[model samples]
Target chain A: MAWTNILTDLLKVNYPIIQAPMLGVSTPEMAAAVSNEGGLGSLPVGGLSPDATKQLIRTTKSLTNKPFAVNLFAHNIPSYSEDDLEPMRKLLLQLAAKRGYDLNAADLSNFKLYNYLDQIDILIEEKIPVVSFTFGCLDPDSIEALKRNACTLIGTATCVEEALYLQQQDIDIIAVQGIEAGGHRGTFIEDMPLPQIGLFSLLPQIKKAVRIPCVAAGGINSARTMKAAVELGADGVQIGTAFIGTEESQAIPSYKTRLNNAKDTDTALTKAFSGRWARGIRNEMMNEIEQAGIPIPPYPLQNSLTAQFRKLAQQNNDIEYTTLWAGQSAVRTTLTQSKDIIRNLIEGYEAL
Target chain B: MAWTNILTDLLKVNYPIIQAPMLGVSTPEMAAAVSNEGGLGSLPVGGLSPDATKQLIRTTKSLTNKPFAVNLFAHNIPSYSEDDLEPMRKLLLQLAAKRGYDLNAADLSNFKLYNYLDQIDILIEEKIPVVSFTFGCLDPDSIEALKRNACTLIGTATCVEEALYLQQQDIDIIAVQGIEAGGHRGTFIEDMPLPQIGLFSLLPQIKKAVRIPCVAAGGINSARTMKAAVELGADGVQIGTAFIGTEESQAIPSYKTRLNNAKDTDTALTKAFSGRWARGIRNEMMNEIEQAGIPIPPYPLQNSLTAQFRKLAQQNNDIEYTTLWAGQSAVRTTLTQSKDIIRNLIEGYEAL
Candidate 1:
């Protein structure tokens, strides 16, 4: 019944629970708070520049001596000319204009896509103890570099085949994401539709196939869910939506409020926001895009196009227009501090 | 942790496991074998005639003296003219012709849809102890008639709202079907897409809201999954896919072979086979319908149209053309006797 296991020993945390590195919401303060409270706090640098990643890691280190993780986006950046993005750009502009937001062509342009390779040296130099990546696995060179630093590498998988592939590539651990997860899907397999296996079904199969520790991600917010994941043979639980409403999270107030008020059925998967499937609370923007039946451009292209529009919506505190990323268990989220959240998890599990 | 909870006590079973009433695959021999092994066996009469239902119940009774459940489909049959069925009928004919199966117009007609209301009296008169239903709830008159006989009533729910509704109607137990469940979805709420909440997310939410005993269904095949469900507060479990490969199951040899060979990602939700959404192994027929982007006629209509084609394909043992209903945990299934499957489940849970 004790939480101590291979994952806890490897990450050097008291509990096997991990705060998910949510790109738009996770903050240095949040990661430090979790790590300081004996859980693995993750710093999401998936969308950040190397300088920003360095600054964030330094700030987190200043706040806590406990171990933490740095997360990166390892997906291949799609090649596209400016002309290829014109149609979606015009559509986004028109949509923004209808909402009384002034978004120009320049607002959607000039966005640079960062490769995970560019940020590897920062992790190695900073002596980051843990590194996790989603959307795909890290390259061999980067893996070798991280391995040289003795970093505990975690790769995210949405199915058994992906978990096997990650283990074969020498990942130290695998974070198996379920369909109930929020944000982007970690499916990297090509020529197939997205694998939407839930945590209950995906965990045991992945555990049976892989030798490395497997952490269950998605829909794990409470101690009951955590224990359930453990019962299904998970080494640990990677929690996201539970921490998104915490005081230290950088998620906008409107997003937090939506998370607080949402129900189990309120969240759904949509590719309209970034052209990659992600689970979030359904809103006007998602509904409009789906109703219009327009084909969304692939990942970074669509992500870049919607950048300014999301920013403006966030600034205006518009819940309907901004991306309100949350998992299916958003109803379990509470707006509390990070330390209290981790404490409640541990205490709840112990009481059970 | 004892399996003797409110559910088992109410249903007069030794264990908290219920064999799912899969419409096409469940058989009296299978149900009785499970009942004889101290599990709650279920005879699925959802698509059977009143005479057939009575015969199945009598056969099962002759095989075992233990308690079992009879399942019914309670949805309103759509009122469609013969003209409404012509186009879909013609399409099925063309598809069957391509597969070298001879079919005439008369072969497709004369398939009668049975109303659950017509089957309630049979249960009352036969003194059946347990009745479960899916697709929708039974009418008030039918409920009163069954309750008058002191029969235990179980209703299927795909979301918390549906679970709450079932509780309000005084259902003795709720078979909370997750998106990972096979066969037809039990979503009855109007103006919404099918609620695809997985067991990991849906179980805790439904358990928190309803006062009745909740039996977790969908993607639960092994002892680990069974324990996971119990940890998440399910009073019992209703298993389906685990029994598809049983020697007593009425599933075709090709279907059982496919189930034995399937992985976690092989099953997907498709509304193409029937008007209503159901999970099954992806086949050429599903791909063809999806690729053609044709609007399938609603249930019973579409069910009738494709009935002959599925039958012909099964007769020829062609896996590609038959409906292979399975849950996400199909990989865990094995070809064995129903009694052995129950014994393995009990032993597995005890070992854990």
Candidate 2:
């Protein structure tokens, strides 16, 4: 039952387990620790600047020589004028005022949105071995550029149609994200509504439809779920929430505590925080914003608009105001080192 | 690999497979066919009257002597006056008019809403050996009465809290209904929103929490999913959508055709048809009712109002307006016999 497959060979990892690149929580130390433990660790640069991304990649390289993935947000950058973000700005201001937080107009202004194309040269220059992306597929030019550098591309998909699209783009691996997945949904199909296909249904369908190695992501925190994903035809598993509790993660103490205390039914999907559908522990911020029934601005704009407020809440350790992204099986998370988490997953899978 | 567990032994089946009692689709022949194939067949008596339930039980008995469970809707009966249902009636009428189907006042009136209590005596009189319930848990009196008659009780839960409640009520087996399940959600806990936990995250959590045997229900169609559920700690599996494709099922031709043609992402959850959350294929009726933004009446009331419209659509083989309830894995379904489905599942598990 020793795990070795196309995913392992392509990613150059001993085990097929992948530490999902969780923005805001994942760090260079966390990624390096997981990779050193024989699992594919991911560095999320979806929200970082090219310079910062280079620094993080250099730091991770300093920590481990093992192959690790660098993840980016491949969404189309929307052209938004200041006026377009006015209503959402007012809403967030109103919400922050209720929480006794002061926000000035300057706090939400001058937000720089990162484009996927801008990050390609940085990955190529850094010689990043594996590149993963979510939100949408990379353009043909970006794909060719990354392929020319010999980077293994992993595209995120929430449905079979998206998986097929990723394969059509000549992507090397497909990360099949189920509805139970935490953080932002990787749904890129514009004409259709957000796909909420569970892993039980999505994994097998994607595996049957696509030829590339499919990695199951979502609510996969334990050996049982990992084994179940493999039984359903997944070549590997991409775990996210479980690693948030690891010592190497950069999550706030309260966020880690909430993950430890969460029940299976404690989480819900809300676009209130980032203007993109994400699974997280239901709190006052999610409830109040959703209850207000106002149209949320799209991602990057809304994500930037609420940045100051989220920072203030994080500083105060106010769990209610800050985002607490988690999967349905986040109840399995425990406070430990990244190495122990990876070792336990391997040992547990072996025992099973 | 021969499936013999607490669930199989208690239900008197050779394989730990329970054909889910899909209300409109399950018939006496369908139930008996599954039971005869060494799987526990279920006769859904939730919507039928006491006399009709007795007759169905007798018919199933005539078809097979193998043990089969009788399913009931244990939700509390809502008190609704004619005036209370008037708004919903008018809304349905307006929607029906748009479809060129005249829903007259007489057609929507005089509907009888059956109570779970009324159906208990029929099971006792018929000497039914196994009983199951969904929507909510049965009252203590009903539980005691069924227990007095030596009936093994199976309760449905969509979350950990509901499963613990069923276990506390002394339920013999718990059907852990995941978000990918079709038909009405079995979530009974009030004061919270509907639980949409996927099977991958839900099964293992319920297995850890409950002392009683747990049966995984939702998105379990083929041998792979069945084996995955067992590996994830399910004592058995309760499949619903797969059986709709069976020849013995009472589902219409168009419904069966849709099931065969559906993809994994085809289904969605909508509360417009029944006032309670249920997953089904996206159709005109669901989209229109949801888009209209009118408040839906509670179950039985909304269910009654939509009955005439659903009937007309079914009669004309118009899949658009019909209630095509299905699971997320409906794409895995094939038009076959109940015996072949059960045999395939058993053989598939063995091969795995």
Candidate 3:
């Protein structure tokens, strides 16, 4: 009678809803409240050190005894050649001089990735109940280690073929992502057309082809749509954009306000921020980047090159440069307490 | 714990999801099936005779014992001067002769529109349980007559001010339709912006200001999204494009095929057909219409003038000239059976 699935039972939530692991947007309080309200809440590992990731998990655990998830970006961090950083630095200086800022150089020491392997080790040692992945799959060693610790593993798949591949690896669940999903595309396989499937069309096809339980992700954010996904054979749903306006999220106040004012037609996927396709509000940065016509470097290097610009822009409330990742349902986000948001989600289910 | 509201209890349904009343696409069989599944089903009264309207209601009643709705066009039907029809007639004659179908002059009489008020008499005589109006509101006499018959009167509103006006007119429910809705724009009092407010931003504001229960319409198709609507404050939802894909629909095979194959960006609202804005798949007719640069006549007359072209195109399986009205959520509709679709919607509610 409660949500009929292993996920709902395992998570002890009323329904098989999962708040998305949105880095720079999700917070420990939000995650904990969602978990407490009987839906799996997730903390993102992107842009975090191992210590920070563990601290977030511990803080979330302190807030609620319910099961929660930790999401990891399993892809290898790209190494930036000095050749790449020098030009990016020169461009920044030139732009800054025009803006009347003193061009004082900062120390360029102690820069390194979070050491994903070390983070995985800590998660496994701590016996985290659920570990979901995006960007790429875990190595065989890591997958086996997580399994050995009796952890539920989920892999994000943008296509049916990818879902089948994940099933072959004996993963517990598959998050069937659609083209409308926010953040970096999880397409690591061959270059597909990004065919733009919706939840109603994609869920059944994945359900028919795969043996594992399917979790519909991407643009789902409503009671009616969640019910529709379940009817289409999705065992659970992962929602991200619906929670952007929650009081507990780490999203900037300006970003949250903009999200509240967005329209369904306001969202678009651009490869401007982070050198990968992500859906967000179209802004000046996207227009400028597309006009520049420069070949964007791959992954972490492109991310690192613009890190300072992003920090300065976000601090200045300049929305253009910051990576404002949100899905098509972003405008549906309501300004409310995280607990109240979960309560309304439950009521939406009940109304349906 | 059933989905039984005061209105649903009065109407004898378990849920509040209403199949939006659509002209040309809606048929008797479709209306009955939705009513049988415990939701409101509406038939549009445009371009139908009094006898035809009564016959449609009788046929729907025979198919199911539950209540159903009938929608009426409240806008002025345009009258064509002899100058307008003469030029159009000559063009039609040229085309017919080219196609080797020499129609007698008498055949032209069949293209004229039946009066809207005459159709209303058939609806009142039938004592229909629900009545809806689009494009404008009816006079006080019409509202009084329907209310005396114990009909639930609903009005379509494009903005918050329009909704307030409908409330003042003593409407039972106000349909808060967004810009993405298919078919003609429902602006009654004033000409609104093209592609004005989207569903997510529009729903909350209307719900906040309007005292009457708001029924959310325009581009809703899934449980998760519907949940968001209800959570934001809609008491019910009315969907058009989703139900258009069902087996009971009167849509051509090619129309359904195109809808299933549509991308997120495939739809556009063009005034090439019906002289009113409607969303559909882009086709050669729309392109040619745009290029022709002829001043479009008013409604009903413009719709009447193009009748021959539409008929011929359909007979030839031509996608052009067909008023394939569908919302932005048309991409999500794939159900072939109404029963299965109703069940899926139920499950979507359960998951929420």
The per-prediction i-RMS, to one decimal, reads 0.8, 0.8, 6.9
Per-residue alpha-carbon lDDT of candidate 2 for residues A60-84, written as tens digits (9 for 90 to 100): 9999999999999988877778888
Candidate 3 lDDT tens digits, B1-352: 2477655755556788888888877888888888888888888876677888888888988998888888888777665676765654555455556555544455544565775577766677888888888877877878888888888888998767788888998888888886557677777765434434555445666776777778888756767556656755778888888777788887887877777876443566677777776777677666666556566566666677667667766676556557677665565455787656667877987876
DockQ value of candidate 2: 0.87
- Work out the TM-score per prediction: 0.98, 0.98, 0.61
lDDT string for model 2 (B296-318, tens) is: 88887788789899998888888
Q: Give lDDT tens digits, candidate 3, residues A1-352.
A: 1476776765556668888888878898988888888888887887578888889888888998888888988677777666655544555455545544443335122346564576888798777888888777888888888899988888888766677888888788899876557777776664644434444345556777788888888656667566556656778888887787788887777888888876544667776667666778877666666566566666665565566666777777767667777775565444477777667767888876
Native-referenced DockQ of model 3: 0.05
lDDT of each: 0.88, 0.89, 0.72
Model 3 interface RMSD, in angstroms?
6.9
- Sort candidate 3 into its docking category: incorrect
Tens-place lDDT digits, model 1, residues B33-119:
999999999999986789999999999999999999999998888888888777777777887888899978887777798788778
